[model samples]
Target: MTARETPESIVVVLGTRPEIIKFAPVIRECLARDVPFTLVHTGQHYSRELDRVFFEQLDLPAPDVHLDVGSDSHGRQTAAMLEGIEDVLVDVEPDVVLVQGDTNSTLAGALAAAKLNVDVGHVEAGLRSFDREMPEETNRVVVDHVAEYLFTPTEETRLYLEREGVAGQVVVTGNTVVDAVYQYADVAAEKSTVLDDLELSPGEFCLLTAHRAENVDHPDRFRSLLAGVAQFADLTGHEVVYPIHPRAQSRLDEFGVDVPDEIRVIDPLDFLDFLRLESTAALAFTDSGGVQEECCILGTPCVTLRYTTERPETVYVGANCLAGLDPADVVAAGSLMLGKQPDWTIPFGDGRAAERILDALTEVETDTDTAAATVTPTETTATETLQ
Candidate 1:
């Protein structure tokens, strides 16, 4: 293999807290390698409380451009972001624009970049739930087709792209969330006092995070999930700890859903605090895709509340199970995962995913024109080459 020049400049676009979390490693990689990059936050899922503290906690540089296109209907939200992102791409004219996961922000960023002739490098690319009811599923498909560089997390995902015949160069770079988890697990443990504060012990609590529209937007579904989770905790004899998103909490209140006394509801936690809980918890029930990846990586058994998941690798490895909204099934799935040994093979890659991704961009590809090489993390400046 030979070395090609690193792209002259890169633009990163993200919106939600998960995006912020998952993209931190890539942003840090840019910093480490002295890559000239710019950060553009669409603010699609912005909250002052979350945005300020999250960046501080991750120790990431602030967004160079904040397109403060906050919450709205899906059409309005994505359209505004698409418009704003196009403007930014026009101004910056970056060589490539980086987007992560399946969100409106991801779709907007990819579309904007593709329209402007800027190459799009999509992280966590080629995921599919096969259920088009999900806005995320649509976003994933569109972004994958539009992207020039598709960085997948697994061989399975790479194969999916192959089957779809996407024109993008696909590389199985592993999930960036795994990289984030490995990077922050020890740091969270050392710095967070969540267990002490919650009066919880290792393997004694069951965490719950239900914020997805499919689960929480409908009153009956929301109520059913709450009851089902309560029953699951009761069956397991584990305390149910719910760190509710403020938006979901309001929806619950609006729906007039009764909370079971067994489930303890609390305000949201920062990344470190939540990581502390998730790492120690006996089990977790969530509608969050990111939580599924994180719990699986942390060796904490998880039951996904959603009907379908883009990260099915977690389920394939026995680290997670899908228990979509039946009280009986929810309890059964939780019970099944509770006593199992955490012997599941880690499917994500070595912790050096960021290094390999950078290497692929800067180093020449193998004869297959697919770059899935791993590299050791060494001091490398912008002009450094992979040899």
Candidate 2:
């Protein structure tokens, strides 16, 4: 092990709603440990609903650096974020940067840090949809290859890292989503009046959240998914409550795809409100990977609108099923899931992922002091050549 150099200083980078929810635990852990960390917001999700609401709802501290780099083409967005993040890394000079999931923001953070010869700790690493077409898959693959420490949610994902021969210390730190759910479920239950506000009763509604680029970018596919969801809602006798994502809503408007009357479209909810609904809903239908994990943990059966999912544990455990965008298939999958009980063993983790992630980070010796587990600082990550 290399001798410890300096006290750990971390830059936590985030841009979207899920990143905020998922990263809250690690931030809270940093507070508890008195680890000096800076929060950097790339502003990838520009809307207040999609970004700021999460920080406020989660009671997370505001970002120390705000890049304000909004949406664009994937190439443009990623390049902008990379440049902005590089500036922050230069200014902060953090020992490591922490990025979560497979968003462009995640990739940018890892890339910026690796370019500067900084260690990167990736949360929820090694997630693979195995579909090259999905931008997320590319982001995940790239970030995993560059990151020094890969904190995966499950042993299955750890094996994925090993199989890929990724040059990183892969640790199976149960997902921080589980930690967030366990920590906030009770709080959400007590504080959230979302059901009452929406005039919804438990088991009376199905939650729908479809914001994947492939699903919403095309008018035909988006409309078909909604039609299928509408059918699923009718079949299950549960009204679909869709807290529409901005991207999906924009496509609906631009493409002039009329949403079915059976599906009630509403504004996006804060994490607490959404979590409350997710916990109480009879069923959930969505294309979101994070929602699948959340519903699985909250005991809500989910019907995935997409064909492929990185988090196949939900399907393996009977908590979720892929219904695709076909109207009939969506209805069938929803019906099948509705018949089953939400008793699948929590496949993500034991609700201590934040602690575990930090523990692994702490184990990473900085400058030549022997730690049982130490992440060797990469002068140039293997992914750099690919970049």
Error of 1 at 334 (Å): 0.7
Q: lDDT for model 2, please.
A: 0.85
Q: Which stretches of candidate 2 lie above 4 Å from their native place?
A: 1-6, 363-387
Model 1: weakest 10-residue lDDT segment is 378-387
Q: Give the lDDT of residue 13 in candidate 2.
A: 96
**TM-score against truth, every candidate:** 0.93, 0.92
Q: After superposition, which runs of candidate 1 have C-alpha atoms over 4 Å from their true positions?
A: 1-3, 363-387
Clashing pairs in 1: none
Per model, state how many residue pairs clash: 0, 9
In candidate 2, list every pair of residues with a backbone clash.
2-367, 2-368, 2-369, 3-367, 3-368, 3-369, 4-367, 4-369, 5-367
